[model samples]
Target chain A: MGRAILTLLWKDLRVELRTKEILTTMMVLALLILVILNVAMGQNVVTVKLAASGVLWVVFTFAATLGLSRVFLVEKERGQLSGILLAPMDRSAIFLGKMIGSTILVLLVEAVALPVFVVLFNFPLGGRVGPLLLPLFLGTVGFIAVETLFSAISAQTRLREILLPLLAFPVAMPALVGAVGATAKVLDGLPLQSAAPELQLLVAFDILFVAIGLVVFEYVVEEE
Target chain B: MVQEDRRAVEARGVKKAFGRTWALRGVDLEVRPGEYLALLGPNGSGKTTLLRILATLIRPTEGNIRIFGRDPRREGEECRRLLGFVGHDSFLYGSLSVSENLHFYARLFGLPDIPARTRQVLEALGLERRAHDLVRTLSRGLQQRVAIARALLHDPILLLLDEPFTGLDAQASRSLGELLASLRQEGRAIIMATHNLNEGLEACDRAVILLDGRVARVMEGPEIRGERLREAFLATLES
Candidate 1:
């Protein structure tokens, strides 16, 4: 099962590497959001500092959605999803592989976007990258688990692009709120304990959604 | 004592409906190991729908199907392990090279020695030379060959092909027919759905004509030869 998941992840990664389809679009959109944010709020350092966490997450959420939609679109367009479904492995492996792939792409986008965001907004990190990393990881896992599942569901529909956000945003609201709160606390140089509650919420969200996705994914991919 | 033949596919009273309209009113079919059966039907004749149900891609609105004596719905994973499906679509990732696509599927099946299995399938389909080419860069024939290679990688005992020769050139089509014949000789049960009447009759040991979601006729041996098969096919449609 693990090997099957790895194979699936490897396939998605190789396709992305060759085409740069998901990464390029996500990075460009993330940069565009940053540039727009900088223009609108960069002039006021104090205000930028206060709003930096919210703006960063806003960029991440929307850019991540753009990337997530492509996670299943390639399969549908090339008819590869049927091939994957026909394989002998447990269906949940497909969900895990896609979730992990989307998580990596979202993180890669964040890796670049974070430094650019700091420079553009002139917000102080205060050597709190350690505290920030935990929430980022948890928040991303929660975000991707739900997004990947909904992306699979929406990909089957005629209005996939429009349907994805409509289905994803509502389910992902709690995780988004948790991510925003935890990020804000960390950026303010507070102790990790200060943001423990938000981290807990993010963790619970990840567990709940990941479990739901694994159990319900087989039904979602089955043709009616 | 005579040994009973293992059944590769057995379906009874299978029916599939989309909303109010029925695609397969009732389909009863059985194929033994080593049997090569060709499905013949006009447009919207439920040929693809029945094939999809056996492949476990979709469920039948009514009735039951067993692949290798295993229920496709209840034991789909087990059934899939012994099944190979080649549809009209290539099902290959266009961005990936031929070898990469095969390797990906080999690994998904968890085949031992992925490199060797990937090379073996590529060589079998005469795709080794074009192994490094992206699938979209290949000709339609080569791409379909790649699809075939991917399907045969796991050495499935039952093969389901839907219009496997839709866009092939004459040479490619002939080669594919020979390939299916050889696989049939090896005791693999094959269910092929095609519009090419002559080729279907020539390659298959038995032929079934479906019309209006039902089996209109079944032909075998000398009955599926020469002009008789074509006449029966037309007659089934007109009647």
Candidate 2:
């Protein structure tokens, strides 16, 4: 089981490394969102600071969705998903592998996007930035778990690009809210303890989405 | 008492429906170990659907299927281990090289000594020479060969192929025919679904014509020779 999951993850990462399809698309979109938002917001330090967490979450969510939408569609391209499904491993390994892959791509995009965001908004990046990782990481895990599952379901549809966000955003709302709230607390220079409730909510959503994904993803990918 | 005597596949009353339409109403078929069976049918005749169900890619709307006596629904992982499937598509990633694609599947199938197994299949399919080339760069025949190598990586006992010769040139088709003959000789249960009746029936011990989601006729031995199967094909569907 461990070998299968790692193999699946390695396969996805290797393909991404070669084509750079998912990561490049995600990074470009993240940067574009940052540039567009910076122009619109007009360097209002107070407004930018207040909306920073929301802006960050919005950027990550949209970019991650764009990337996640292709995660399973790549497999569908050459009917590779059927080949993988015909392999003798537990189906949930596929979900975990894709979720982790999407998480890694989203995180890499965030790593680059965060700095540009700070520079664009003229926000200081002192000790306050340290606590933001927890929410960002946890929120991504939860967000990816839901999106990866929906990505599999949506990839089978004719309108996959349009369907993924519609299906995932509603389901991933709690994690988004939790991440934004926790990020807001962090940006405010509050202690990590002050953001405990939001952190807990993020953790809860992560556990719930992952657990449900493990159980339900197989059925979603199954053909009628 | 030998494993060779056991049935490699046994499906009974298998039915599959997509909403209001039915793809397979009741498909009862069996294949012995080392036997070659061909599934022949017209468009929308449920050849692919039946293959997909036996491959466990889709559930039958009704009925039971067993791979070497193990229920596919109850023991999918084990059943999957016993079978290899090659659909119409190559199923190889265009960005990855031939060797990379095979190695990926070898690892996914949990084959021990991945390099050795990957090397063996690559050599078998005559893909070792082009192992480093990206799949998209390879000719269609080579890509299909890579797909076959990936399917055979785990050394399954049952092999299912759907329209494998659809796009092959005459030479490539001949190569595939030779490969199928060798696999059949190795005692693997083979079920090939193809529209090329001449090529499809040439190497098979038995053949079945499917129409409207049911097996309309089964031909064997001398009955499958010459123009009989083709005659039966047109006659069955026309009726």
Clashing residue pairs found in predicted model 1: none
Q: Against the true structure, candidate 1 has what lDDT?
A: 0.89
Q: Is model 1 an incorrect, acceptable, medium or high docking prediction?
A: high
Q: lDDT per residue, candidate 1, B188-211, as tens digits? A: 889999777866447688999999
DockQ of 2: 0.85
TM-score of 1: 0.97
Taking the tens digit of each residue's C-alpha lDDT, what string does model 1 give over A139-216? 989999999999999998889888998999999999999999999988988898999899999999999999999999
Q: What is the TM-score of each candidate against the true structure?
A: 0.97, 0.97
Count of residue pairs whose backbone atoms collide, per candidate: 0, 0
Question: Residue A68 in model 2: shift from native, Å?
Answer: 0.9
Q: For residues A18-78, what per-residue lDDT tens digits would candidate 2 score against the true structure? A: 8998899999999999999999998888989889999999899999999999988878876
